[model samples]
Target: MNKCYIDGSIGQCGHSSRSADKAAASGTVMDLKKDFHMNSGAGDNSYARNSKIQGLIISKSQSERRKAAVAAYLGTGRPATMSVADLGCSSGPTALLAVEDIMVAVERACVELHGQPPEFNLLLNDLYGNDFNALFRSFPEFNSRRQGKGLCFVTGVPGTFYGRLFAAKSLHLVCSSSSLHWLSQMPEELQQKEGSPAACVNKGKVFISAGSPPCVAEAYRKQFHRDFTTFLRCRAEEIVRGGLMVLAFMSRKNREAALMEDRYIWGLLEDALNAMASEERIDSFDAPFYAPSMEELEEEIGGEGSFCIRSSDQFLVRWDDDNQYSGTGGEANVTARPVKHAVRMAKGVRAVAESMLRSHFGEGFGMDDLFCRYGGLLAQYYADSEAAVTNVVISLVRK
Candidate 1:
C-alpha cells in the first residue's frame, strides 16, 4: 500500500488527488480505478492509533453514537449481508475498534433481522505508506474472533478514502473518524503565496492579518470548498443507497472565538519555532491545517448534494487533567503538570500538529517548540475548568 498520493488537484476538503498529472502529495481525490502510485504520507498510521487512544481518553460519546448509527441503519429493510468500510483504517488499532463496534452494533440490530448475525465483509483501508506489517499484527486476534459467529471477513486494502475505493453502491456503511480534514495535497497557489496573506505570520504563528490581501484569502477558501465538496461526492458514490456514514473530525468555532483564542495557539507555535530557530534547533517554519468551524463545515456540507445530514453534535474533549495549578502568574493558570501518563498524552497532541506542520512546511522542522507553547496555551485554556467543546461530529446517510 502506498502511504501518500501526490496530486495537486483539490477534491473534497482539498485532500484527494483527482489527477496526478499535476504536482501534489498524499490524499488526493481520484477514481479508484485510476492507475496511480501510492506514497507514504497516507501510511502514517501512528496518528490514527494515537487518535484511538485520545478518543478513549477524551470522548467515548462518538463511539456510542457511531455504534447506534450502524444499528439504526441495519434496522431498515437492508439485507442480512452488509458491506462496511473504514476509510482511514491506518495500522489497525483504531480500525479494529471501529470495526468491532460496528460488528457489535450490527449484531444488536440483527435481533430483529433473524436469529443469526449478518454475514459481513469489512474492508480496512489506509494509504499504501501504512505499516501493513503493524496492521497485520492484529490479524490473528481478528481471525480468532471470527470462528464463533456469523460468516465475516476482514481484509487490509491500502488506498486513500477520498476516491471511490469501493464499488458503487457496494458499501452499506462507511465510517471515517478524525480524518477528512486534509485537502488534496496543498494548493500550488497557496504554496506560491510567499509573502501574501495566505502566508502571513506573526510571532512565529501563521495567521491572516487584517492587512492580508483579499485574493489570498479567497483563493484558499475556494480551494478548501472545491476539495471538501469533491470529498463528499466521491464518498457519495461509494455508499449504497440508504447507506449511513458517521464522520467525526476536529472543527473550529466562530471566527471570533477562533481568532481570539484559537489563533493564539498557532502564534504560540510561532513563538516556539522562533525560539528554536533562534537557538538553531530548527531551520524553518510550517503550519498545519486545523479543524474548520461549525459554520465553515456546515457551509461545505450544505453545498454538497451527495449526502443528507441526519445529526450533528459538538462536544468538548475532556482534557486528561485534574485541574491543579502552580506558580503565581506565569504558569499559575496552567494545569498542574501531567503525570507519567501525560508522556503519551503530550506525544499524541504533538503528533497531530506535527503531521499538519510537515504537510505545510517540509521535513527537518521539529515540533518541540510548538508543543511547549501550545501545551501552555491548552493548559491555560482549560484552567477555568470550562467545558472545552472544540470538536464536531456529523452523521450522514446517502441521499
Candidate 2:
C-alpha cells in the first residue's frame, strides 16, 4: 500500500501509515499477512514486552549496522537526504531501536567527515497486518533519542518482502533483523493433502525433526532458495548502486546445526502439542520456518548477481542466557531458579508463534495448556542438551 511506484514516480513516504492500516483491515488480506504479525500492544504478553531475544539480535548486529551506515554514506557519496528502510520491521520498541543505531552511526560518520549529516527518509516495512499503530505511538520515544542527529521522516510500508515494495533505485540502505527465516507462506509441497503420495505429511512431527524424511528437508531448502533469491532480486532493483544492506536472521552452520535448533525450538512445540492433544494436530501442522546455512545464503546472493558480500558473522545465542529486560532464564538462572526459565521461554515462544498456532488449530485452542506443556519441555530440553541457536548477519553492497 506504499505510494511508491516501480516506474520511479516519487512521493512523500508519509501516506504509508493510513494506507497500511486500511490494507491490514481489507477483506482480501493474504493468508500469511493476516496471521504473521507479533502481538500488537505493550501488555504483559505483547511483543514489545517479550521481545528481548530479538532485541539482543539487533544489539549483536550493531557493528554491522554501524559499518553499513558508513559504507552507504561513503559508497553513495553522502547524499543530502538518504532514504533507508527496515524490512519486516514488526511493531515493537526494538523496531525503532534499530533505526536509532543507524541514525547515530550516520551522524557520527558525518561528524568524522566534517560534513553536514544527511537528513533521513526512514521507512518501516512489514506485512499488511503489522501493528503500525503501536509503532507510531512509540515514535515519540524514538524521537526523544535523536538529539543532534540528522532529521528523520519515518513512515510505514505494508507488504511482504517476497516482492517489490519500493521504486527502482529508491533506497540508499536496507536492513532486517530476526526475520529472514520465515517462508512467505507454507511450502507448497507440505500443504498437499495428508494421504496423498506427494504430500509431505510429516507423520508424527510438526517440523523437520531428526526422523523426518529427506524430502521434507528438501522441500524446506527449495522454498528458502526460492524466497531468498526473489528477496535479493527485488532489493537489487530498489537499492541504488553501491547502497548497503545489513540482514540478521536465525541461521544454521550446516544441516547438523539445523536439526539441533529444530529439536530445541520447534521440537518443544511438537512435544507440547502431542501431549496436549492427540497426534491429529501434530500431523496436520507445519511451521513456515527454515534456517539456512551461510553457504546457502552466499550461493543465492551470487546467483542473484546484484550484490557482493562485504562481511558476515555467526553469533551463538544461548537459550539459557538470562535477559534482564525479558526476565528470561539462562544457565545460571536455571541452576538457581528453574520456574522462571520455563515462564521466560514459554512466554517468548507464545509471543511470536501463538498466532499461527491458534490460526492452524482453532481460535479457541487452549493457549494456556499448550504453553504450560511448552514450558515443561523447555526445562527438560535444557536438562538434556546444551541449547543455542545460530544467527547470521551479512553486510552487502549493491553492485
Candidate 3:
C-alpha cells in the first residue's frame, strides 16, 4: 500500500512523478497519514477508466437535468457573475468534460442574458493527493479552450465537500458526479461474526461480517448525512441569495425487495471472499462500501435547512460490447474473478490480496492488470445479471 501510494504521486498538484518518487524514498505513507486520504493511490484511476468507457453517459444525462434545474432556479435575467465548482474532481481528462459542458451551458444561458453570459468562476476541488498529473498533462488543451474567456482554475482549499469544501454564500453553480457516496471514515467497531474463527488469525486483517450490524450500516448513512448537511449549509453560505447548485451522483433504490443485495457487485466481491473462506483460501473478508440511494439522499438533503429538491430521478446505464472485457469476451477464466474485485479494491482497502499476488502468486500483479480485470469482471457481471444495472444519477439543488 505504501508503494502504491508512492507510485501515483497522490495528494499533490500536477502530474509530476517526482513527488511520488520523493515520497517513496522518504518512506512517507500519505494515505495512512493524519490528513490525507482519497489520493489517486487510494482511489486509483477507476473513475478515470470508467469515465472513458462510460463517457459521461449517466453524468451527462444528469448534467442535462441539472442544467434545466439551474435554469429554472435562476430564471431569466440572471446576474452576470457566476461561479461553479466540481467537488471531488479527479484527473484532468475526467474533469475537463464537465468544464466543457458547463461552458456550453454558460453560452446557452448567455443568449437569454441579452448578449453577455455570466462571468463564470469554475472551481475544481478534490483531495490534495489526487492525480493532478492527468490534469497538468491536459492543461494546454484547457487553456486553449478558455483562450478568450475569464475562467479560473484553482486547487487545494479547505473543507472536504464531505463536510464543507467551500465558504458560505459563495457559489452560483456547484457540480459533482459519482463522488458523494464515499464516507468520511470507515467503521471501527464491526467485527466478524463468531462462526469466523479465521477472524482471530491475523492482526493485519480487520474484517467485517457479511451481515453488518445496524450500527455499521448506519455509520456510513450518518456520515453521509453529516457531510451532506454541512455541505449544503456551506454552499448555502457561499451561494448568492438565489444561486444554483447542480449535483449528480450514484444512487441506489429504496425498496427492500428491489434494493441491491450483496449479490450486486460491491457485495458480491465480499461474498467471493467468503467463498474463498469456505474453501479456507483466506481467513475472512471485509464487506463492500457504497453511496446512498436517491431516496436517502433526497430525504437527507430535504431535511437539511439549506436545500430543496428542484429535480431528481433514477436512470439505468446498460453495458455495451465496445466496453467489454478488453479485446476478448471472457477468454480469461481463472484470472476473471480477481479482475473486478481488484479494481474495486484499488481504492486501497484490501492490500493483502494485492501483495500476495505480486510476491506470492507469481502472476506479475500490477495496478493496470488489477484495473483491467476489475473492469472486465464488472462488464461481465452486468452482462450476466438481470438486476445489476448501474446506479442512476440523483440531481439536486440548493433552496
Candidate 4:
C-alpha cells in the first residue's frame, strides 16, 4: 500500500490515478478520512502553536459566523434542541472558539424570540489522525469559560468533511475555517507515474506557480471542483432545509490559481528546493492545495444546486497579520524584521507541510537547511513590499 503525507501526518493513500473515474463507477473513490491533519500536539512546530494566523483569519469572519448561526436557528423555529457541526476543527485554542460563538448566537436569537435556549449537540470534525485527544483535553476549560446558557454536548467526530458524516436533516449549522482549499487527493495528472519520464509535470514546485504548465492549473481546478461539489452534496444531505453553512478558506484574487498571493510563498520554497536539486528534493513532489477564484467558487456552488449563496465576500490578510513583528523605524530594525517574519512564516508552513516534505524527500534531506534558505528567500521577497493573502468567506443556505 502506498502512503501519503497530508498536513504533516502519515496515512495510507487510497487514491489511485483513476480516482475520478472510479468515483463515477462506484459512487466514491478516494477515502481521505484516514489522511490529512495539521501537525498534532503542542510541540514547537505543532499547528497548535503556529496557527495564530489562522485564528486571526477566523476572528475576521466573526460577524458572518454569528449571523449565519442565528439565521439558521431562527429558520428552524427555535427548536428546543439543535445540532451543530464544526468541520475541520483542528486541535488548538481556536478549536472551540467557533462552537462557543455559534452557541451564543443561537441563545441570543432564542431570547429575542422569547423561547428557551436549545441544548446543543456540537460535533467537531477533522481527519482521523488529528489530535482530537488534545482537543478533548481542553474541553473542560472551554466549558467552564463558556458564557452561554444551555446544555452543550460536544463530541469529536473523526472523519473527512468531504463526504457525508451526519444523518439526513440532522444538522442546523455547519462551519469550516482554513480548510476546503485542500483537494481530497493530489491531482492525478500531477502524480508521479511509475517508469514515466514526464510523470511529474509540476517539477520543482510544491503548488501552482508562474512556471507551472497550463495543464497543471487545469488539473488543480478540476480536483477542487470535484471535491467542493462532493462537499456541497454531502452537506445538503445532512443539513436541514433552510440551515446555514459559513465556510472561510484561502482564495486568490486572480482568476488564475498560479498568480495568487500565497502561491508566492510556495514559489519561494520551490527556489529553495531547486537550489538543492542534486539532492532530489524537488522530484515528484506536489502540494495538494488550490486557492480558487470567486468565479470558480460561484460556478461550483451554482452547479451543485444544493445550496443558495446568502453572502459572499473576499478579504485580505497580511503575511504578518498576527503582529508577530515589532520593529521600530530604522535601517537596523527594518533589516531584522523581515528575517524574523520569515522564520515565523517558515514555522507556519512547516506546521502544515513538513510531513509531506519529509515523506516525499527522504527524512535525511536536511529540512532545517531547506527552511533556512526558504526563510531567507521569503525575507528578500517581502523586502520590497508587504505581503498579503486573500481569503473568501461565503455563507450559504441548504435549498
Over 274-364, each residue of candidate 4 has an lDDT whose tens digit, in order, gives 6654423354556778889999999999999999999988998775676656536678777766666666777788788776565555445
lDDT on C-alpha atoms for all candidate structures: 0.53, 0.76, 0.48, 0.77
Model 2, range 245-348, lDDT digits (tens) per residue? 99999998765433645456887778666655444445656788888888888888998889999999999876446554245557765553344455666777
Query: 287-392, model 3: which lDDT tens digit per residue?
Result: 2234567667767776886766666666655333234434455656434433333333333223212322222212232334333333333434544554223455
Candidate 3 error regions (>4 Å): 1-50, 57-59, 62-77, 147-159, 188-210, 213-215, 261-263, 271-288, 321-383, 386-388
Q: Find the candidate with the highest lDDT and give its number.
A: 4
Per-residue CA lDDT of candidate 1, range 1-399, in tens?
A: 111111211111121222211222232222222222222133432454445443552244456455545643654345677787877665545557676677777776667556567788888876665666776777888778766767777777776665667777777887776666554543334442435454332223244333334553454456567767877888788777677877776566665323423344445455434443332112222232445667777778888877777777766564443332233445522333332223334445455555445443334443443444444444444445442336667777787
For every candidate in turn, the CA RMSD to the true structure comes to 10.4, 11.2, 9.6, 7.9
Candidate 1 lands at a TM-score of: 0.70
Q: What is the lDDT of residue 385 in candidate 4?
A: 61
What candidate 1 gets wrong by more than 4 Å, as runs, is 1-53, 57-59, 62-76, 112-115, 145-147, 187-189, 193-204, 207-220, 255-265, 277-288, 321-345, 353-389
lDDT of 1 at 80: 71
Query: Which ranking of candidates, highest TM-score first?
Result: 4, 2, 1, 3
- TM-score-better candidate, 2 vs 4: 4
What TM-scores do the predictions have?
A: 0.70, 0.87, 0.66, 0.87
lDDT assessment of candidate 2: 0.76
